[model samples]
Target: MGYLTCKFVRPDKQLFEGKCASMTLVTYSGELGVLPGHASEICALGDGVVRIKRLDEDGGDERDVVVSGGYAEICNDVVVIIADHARAADDIDAETVRRTHDKAQAKRDALPEGDHQRAYYENKMAWCDLLLEKAGAQTASE
Candidate 1:
């Protein structure tokens, strides 16, 4: 079977670089699936989980990461994800995420309805929720 050269990078460093059989990720338009021969295109990424399936000598290996936001580019059977913020599900600190989520939720609740600051806090809480969900899913899969 054909494979894709996948690279995932964050502002601080490259998080992943390898070959994968397939990848699924969230985009601004919606969820997108990329295979070995996917058409070349560029898409704005959304906050969600990115799943990669890799094939090795032994068998298939699946990995997941939480991406806050960014862009994805595909070309010549190569896929690159440049994320604003990303961390492997296994690397996430669940306790830290929970604390941040609680703080953001509390701040949003204290603000008056329709306040602009509330939106910011709401977004932060949502991001934390996504991370927490991904972390839980990873743990359950183990």
Candidate 2:
């Protein structure tokens, strides 16, 4: 099978780099699958899971990463993911994320009845949902 070079980089360091048979990136709009010789494009990523399938690896070798938000660029036989925040499945702390989700939920619940609070809650809920979804997918796939 043909492989395409894939790399994910954040501000701190180079997150990952390798050749893969297929790669999928999660954007606020939806998930996009990329393969060798795929047309180039750019997508706005949301907080969610980035799934990857290595070309020569076995089924058990699939991997996933969680990113807060970022830009995904597909070009020149390469997939470049630059995220605002990111962590691999192994790096995810479910307890920490759960706590954060709880705290956000609490803040949302305690807010006075108003548009401002409502918007805040909505945003918080969105973030929590993304975190939970990514976490769940990561655990299930790994």
Give the top-scoring candidate (lDDT): 1
Q: Write the per-residue lDDT of candidate 1 for residues 29-106, one digit (tens) a residue.
A: 789999988999999999888889887752688888889889999999999999998988878899999999999999
Q: Score residue 15 of candidate 2 by CA lDDT.
A: 84
Q: CA lDDT, every prediction?
A: 0.89, 0.80
Candidate 2 residue lDDT tens string, 11-130? 898888988888888899888888888899999988778888876654527678878788989998889889887778777677787788788788877878774876866776676566
Supply candidate 1's per-residue lDDT for 42. 95
Report the C-alpha displacement of residue 122, candidate 2, in angstroms. Answer: 8.9
Q: Could you tell me the lDDT of residue 89 within candidate 2?
A: 72
Residue 33 in model 1: shift from native, Å? 1.8
Q: Where does model 1 exceed 4 Å of error?
A: 104-120
Error of 1 at 84 (Å): 1.9
lDDT of 2: 0.80
TM-score of each: 0.80, 0.71
Best by TM-score: 1
